[model samples]
Target: MVPPLALDIDGTLTTPEGTIAPRAFPLLAAWEAPVVLATGKAFPYPVALCQFVGIPERAIAENGGVALVDGHLDYAGDPERVDAAVEAFEERGGDLGWDGVDTVNRWRETEVAVSPTADEELLRDIAAEFDLAVVDSGYAYHLKSPDASKGAALTDVAETLGHDPGEFVAVGDSENDASTFAVAGESYAVANADETAKRAADRVLDRGYVDGTLDALRAIRDRAKNGE
Candidate 1:
């Protein structure tokens, strides 16, 4: 069987214009392995995207803060812990309502995504204050529990679908995706990815957005056919 593909949302799936590439939907449908939408978007958004793509394989949302299965959200982090983290973050003048890069804090559960201008160390300190963790998600920094992560969510869903964590092709274009890259047997980063993510990936695609993702997927399909 072809290994599953764990995909990042934002910069990886959408073009620079922030629209899903027209070719992406069908390619996702025809792919050999399961396609999991792993993103920082809220739980419902990715699930809705799955419906739009006509595939409901599995989805990881909120930067690994939760997993959506069978139309129900499976909370991956302690709500109380996350709330405490949020309080601490705000008390230190860290904005929970940051919208610097076209992102809003509305409707997000378990974790909060702040503007890119946020101080990483300060955020980490806040997380540490509440025994939580802060992760960089390319466009923003995320505050979540230390154990809640995209890699763990991917592995969890992969196992439910009868796949191994190491047999996946994780693809992304952000620092948050580094965790997924670390766990996957193979990882690909889009041309627009941050340096940290590019370093984590096994290969960096020449193109950006879903086109580059399709390019990588087609390459993977070819390698599988060749028994490579």
Candidate 2:
């Protein structure tokens, strides 16, 4: 049988310009097994992606701070802790670098996302001070609870869905996806993947972006056919 799929959005499912790949929606919606959208993005983003793709609403968002399976919601991060960390970051002369209303984090429920233009080192330092974790998703820097990791969220989601976490295959392209790579039965890092993701994955695909994801899915199908 084909294993479930856990996919990262931004750089993995989208084109270089950050829009969803034209071929992605139909393929994911038609996949034989469950498809879980896993990312550092807020809850709404993945939920919407699943809806528009015509798939079940299964997602792990906010770098694992939040998970939604079917209609049930689960939360791992404490908003109070994230609020404190964001306050400390601002007090330390840190600018989130958003040009206007900071829409990047306006609807986020668990973590604070800083633009790539901000000081990553200083943000990491601030996150450490508050006992939080910082992960660079290539598109942005996320400050979140250390306990909230994609791997842990996958495990929780898998149990809730009546499957083992190891029965899922994960595809991604950033350091934030490393934890997921660790938990998945098989993991692939696209060509443009960060070094962390490359190191964590079982194989690094030759293609990048959605092309690489398509390749990974093909490989999974081949493996099932071969009884691997």
Error of 1 at 202 (Å): 1.2
Model 2: which ten-residue window has the lowest total lDDT?
A: 22-31
Judged by whole-model lDDT over C-alpha atoms, candidate 1 comes out at 0.82
Residue-level lDDT of model 2, residues 1-228, one tens digit each, is: 889999999889988778888687776777888899999998899999888999999999999999999778999977798899888888888988989787789889989899999988888888888888888999889888889998999999999888999999999999999999999999999999999999999999999999999988987888888998
**What overall lDDT, based on C-alpha atoms, would model 2 receive against the true structure?**
0.90
* Winning model by lDDT: 2
Give the number of the best model, judged by TM-score: 2
The deviation in Å at residue 219 for candidate 1 is 1.4
Models 1 onward score TM values of 0.89, 0.96
User: What is the C-alpha lDDT profile of model 1 across 23-82, one tens digit per residue?
Assistant: 788878877778899998777778888888888748898888888755456678876887
Which pairs, if any, clash in model 2? none
What lDDT does the true structure give each of the candidates?
0.82, 0.90
